[model samples]
Target: MIDISRTLNADTPTWPEDEPFSYDLTASIADTGSVNIGQFTTSCHTATHIDAPFHFNNSGLTVDQLPIDLYVGRVLVVDVTTKQRITPEDLALIDLQGVRRVILKTDTWPNGAPFPTEIPELDARLGSFFHEHGVELVGVDLPSVDPLDSKTLDTHHAFEANDIHILEGVTLDGVEAGLYHLSALPLKLEGADGSPVRAILQEI
Candidate 1:
C-alpha cells in the first residue's frame, strides 16, 4: 500500500489563518506510571481531509453522515500536471466509465511541502461532468479544487450541489496514473465540517 496522506504536524500547511495541527502529551508514562497519553488539536480542514457538504452549505450533510463507500473503492488516478486550469476538455480522452472515485495527480505540490500560494484550478464544470459519469468522489493533490483565494468557492458548491464529494490535500507525488484500490476514510466527527483521513492506495 502506498500512503497518500500528508503527515499531520505543527509544520503541516493549513489554510491561511486556519488552526495549525498540534500534539501534546497529556499524561506522560513517568507521571502516570502507565502508558503515555497524548492529545491533538487541529482544524478539520488541515492536512489530507474530506470536506463534508456542511463545510459550505448550512443544510448539507455533516462528516458523520457521509457514505463510507465513497471513500473506499476502485479509483482512477489521472495525471493532469500540465495544466494550470483543468477543465473537462483536458480530461476528454481519459475513460471514467464505472469509476466512482477519481484522484487527479497534479503533482504541483510535490514532496509534501508547505502550503502553496497557487495551484492548479479544477473548473467548476467538473461537478456536473463527474456527476454525469457517476463519479461519487473527487480527490486532488492540491489543497483545494478551487483557487486558494476564492471567496465564492464555486467548485466546492458545484460539487456539493451535484452530490459529488471532495477530498483535498492528498499526496500523490510518486503514485502513477492508473487504477488503484483507495482507502481514505474520514473520522466520525459529529456535526463537524470535515475530518482528516489516512488516505492510502493499494496496487490492484
Candidate 2:
C-alpha cells in the first residue's frame, strides 16, 4: 500500500491563520510509568482531509453523514502537473470509463514545503463533467479546490450539486498516474464539517 496521508505534526503547514497542527505528551511513559499518552489539536482541514458538503454548504451533510463507500473504492490518479487551470476541456481527452473517483496529481504542494499562496485552479464546470462520467469523488494534492481566499466556493458548491465529494491535501509526489484502490476514511465526527483522513492507495 502506498500511503498518501500527510504526516500530522508541528511542521505540517496549515491554512494561514488557521489552527496549526500540534501534539503534546499529556502523560509520558516515565511520568505515568506506563504507556505514553498524547493529545493533539488541529484544524479539521489540515493535512490530508475530506471536506464534507457542510464545509461549503451550511445545509449540506457533515463528515459523519457522508457515505462510507465514497471514501474507499477504485480511484484514478490523473497527472495534471504544471497545469495552471484544470477544466473539463483539460480532462476531455482522458478516458474516465468506469472511474468513480479521481485524484489529480498536481505536484503543486511539495512535501515539507510551506503553505502555498498560489495553486492551480480547479474549474467549477468539471463538476458536471465528472458527474456525467459517473464520478462521485474528487481529490486534490492541495489545500482547497477553490482559491485559498475564496469566500464563494463555486467549485465546492458545483461538486456538491453534482453529488461529488471532496478530498484534499493528499501527497502524490513520485506516485505515477494509474488505477488504484483507495482507502481514505474520515473520522465519524458528528456535526463536523470536515475530518482528517489517513489516505492510502493500493495497486490494483
Candidate 3:
C-alpha cells in the first residue's frame, strides 16, 4: 500500500489561527516505572482528513455516522495539475463511469509544506457531476474543496446535498493517475465535525 497521508507533527500546517498539532509526553518511563505515555491535541481538520457533512451543515451527519465502505474501494486518480479553477468542463475528458471514489491529483500543494493561502477552486457543479458518475467520495491534495477564504462554503454544501463525502489534504505527488484501491477511513468520533484519516492506496 502506498501511503497518501501527510505526516502530522508540530510543523504540520493548519488553518490560519487554528490550533496547531502538538504531542507531549504526559508520563515518562522513569517517573511511571513503565512505558512512556504520550498525549496529543489537534484540530479535527488537521492534516489528511475527511470532513463530515456536519463540518459545514449543522443538520448533516457527523464523522461516526459516515459509511465506512465509501472510504475503502476502487478509486480513480485524475491529474488536473494545470487548472486553477476545476469545473466539469475541465474534467470532461476523463471517463468516470462506475467509479465510486475519485481522487484528483492537483499537484498544487504537493508536499503539504504549509497551509496554502489559496487553491484551485472546485466548482460547485462537481456535486452534480460526481453524482451523475456515481462517485461517492472525492479526495484532493489540498486543504479544502472550496476556496480558502470562502465563508459560504458553497462547494462543501453542494457535495453534502448530493450525498458526497470529502477527503482532503491527501499527498498525491508521486502517485500516477489510474485505478487504485483506497482506504482512507476517518476516526469514529461521534458528534464531531471531522477527523484525521490515514489515507492509503493499494495497487489494483
Candidate 4:
C-alpha cells in the first residue's frame, strides 16, 4: 500500500513573506535535570495546517470547534499543475461525481521558492466549486490558496462562507492522483484561527 502524507515539521516551507519556520531546543536532558523541551514560534499558517473559519471571519468557529469528521474521510487527488491560477473553469474539467475530500497537486507543491508575493493561487470561483460540490476538506501542496498579496482573500472568504475546511502547506511530492483514505488532524488550539496538522493518506 502506498502512503501519501507529508511529514510536518518546523522545516516545512511557508508562505511567501510570512514568518520563516524555526524550532529551538530550549531545554535538554543533558543541559540540566529537566525534561527535553523545545520552544518555537511561528504563524499558525506555517507548515501543513488547517485554516478554521476564524482565520477569515471575526467571530467564526476556531480550530477546536471543528467537527471530528471534517479532517478524516475519503479523498480524491486532482492534478491541476497546468493552470497557474486554479479557477472554476479548471475544476469544470474534473470528474468530481462522488469526491467528498479533494487534494490538489499542482506546480505549486514544491512551491518553487518562497517569494515576496503569491504566484500560483486558487481563484475564488474555485472556492464556490468546493462548497457547492459537497467537498468537506480541501488540501493543496502550496503554502496558501490565496495570493500572498491578496488583501481581500477572496478564496478564503468564499470557502469560509460555506464553512469549509481548508488545508494548506501540503507536500504532495510523491502522491499519485487517485482516491485514498485521508487523515489530517490539527492541534486543538483554543479559540485560534488555525493550527498545524499531521496529514497522511493511506491506501485502502
Candidate 5:
C-alpha cells in the first residue's frame, strides 16, 4: 500500500491567512498519572482532504453526508506534470471509459515544501468532461483545483454542478501513473464543509 496523504504538522502549509495546524498535550502522563492526552486544531481544508459540496455551497451536503463509496475504488493516476493548464484535451489520450475516480499527479507540491504561490490551473471545462466520462471523484496533488487567488471558484462550482467531488492537497510524489485501488474517505464531520483524509493507494 502507498500512502498519498500529506502529514499534518505545525509546519504544514495552509491557505493564505487561514489557520495553521497545531497540536499539544492537553493532559500528559505526568499530570494525569495515566495515559497522555493530546489535542489538535486545524482547518478542515488543511493537508490531504476531501471537500464536500458545502465547502462552496451553503446548501450542499456536509462532509459526513457524502457517500462513502465515492472515495474508495479503482482510481486512475494521470500524470500531467509540468502542464500549466489542465484541460479536457490534455486527457484525450487516456482511456477514461468506465473510470469513476481520477487522481491528477501534478508533481507541483513537493512534500514538506512551503505553500506554493502558484500552481497548475484546472480548466473549468474539465468538470463537464469528467462528468461526461462518468467520473464521480477528482483528486489533485495541489492545494486546490482552482487558482489560489480565485474568488469565483469557477472550476469548483463547475464540478459541483456536475456532481463531482473534490479531493485536494494530496502528496503524489514518487507515485507513478496507473490504476490503483484508492481509499481516501473523509472524516465524519457533521455539518462541516470539509475534512482531512488519510488517502492511500494499493496495487490492484
Candidate 6:
C-alpha cells in the first residue's frame, strides 16, 4: 500500500488566505530531561484531512459520526484537470459508470505559493450529480472541493445536503489516474468537525 497523503507536520501547507498550520512541543524530552512529551496547536483541516458534514452544516454529522467503512473502499480516480476549476463539464469527461468512491485529481498540492487563493471552485451542479449517484466520498487536492471564492457556497451545500464526506488538502501530484483501494482514515477526535489523516492508497 502506498501512502498518498502528506505527513501531518508543522510545515504542512494551509489554505492560502487562511492562517498557516503550526504545531509546537510545549513539553519535550530535552526540556523535561525525563520523557519525550510535547503539546501542539494546529487546525484540524490542515494537511491531508477529512471534512465532516458539520464543516458545512451547523447540525450535520461530526468526524466521530462518520462510518469507518467510508474511509476504505474501492475508489475511482477521475483525472479531470483540463479546467482551472472542476465543474460538471470537467467531471462529465470521466466514465463514472459504477464508481462508488471518487477522487478528483486537480494536481492540487502543497507547494510554492506565498499566498493561497481560491482559484479552483467546483460547479454547483456537479455536487448533485455525485450525491444523486450515491458517491460515498469525494477527495481532492485543493483546500476544498468548492470554489475558494464561494461565499454562499452552493457547491458545499449541495454535497452536505446529502451527508457527503470530503477529503481535501491532498497532495496527489505524482499519482497515476486510475482505480485503487483508498484507506485515508481520519483521526478519532470526538465531536470534531474534521481530522488530519494519513491518507493512503492501497493497490488491489
Over 4 Å off, model 1: none
TM per candidate: 0.98, 0.97, 0.98, 0.86, 0.98, 0.87
lDDT of each: 0.93, 0.95, 0.93, 0.77, 0.95, 0.76
Candidate number with the higher lDDT (1 or 5): 5
Candidate 6 ranges beyond 4 A from true positions: 16-19, 30-34, 108-115
| RMSD for each of the candidates | 0.7, 0.9, 0.8, 2.6, 0.7, 2.3
| Candidate 2 residue-wise lDDT, 1-204, digit = tens | 999999999899999878999999999989988889999999999999999999888899998889999989999999999698999999999999999999999999987888999999999999999999999999999999999889999999999999999999999978999999999999999999999999999999
Candidate 4 regions with alpha-carbon error over 4 angstroms: 1-12, 16-18, 31-34, 111-117
- Clashing pairs for model 2 are none
Q: Which ranges of candidate 2 are over 4 A from the true structure? A: none
lDDT of 1 by residue, 1-204 (tens): 999999998888888889899999999999999899999999999989999999888999999999998999999999998899999899889999999999999998975687899999899999999999999899999888989999899999999989999999899978999999999999999999999999999999
Which clashing pairs does model 1 show? none
TM-score of 1: 0.98
Q: Is candidate 1 or candidate 4 better by TM-score?
A: 1
Candidate 6, 115: how far from true, in Å? 5.3
Candidate 3 error regions (>4 Å): none
Q: Which residue pairs clash within candidate 6?
A: 16-116, 121-147
Candidate 5: stretches off by over 4 Å:
none
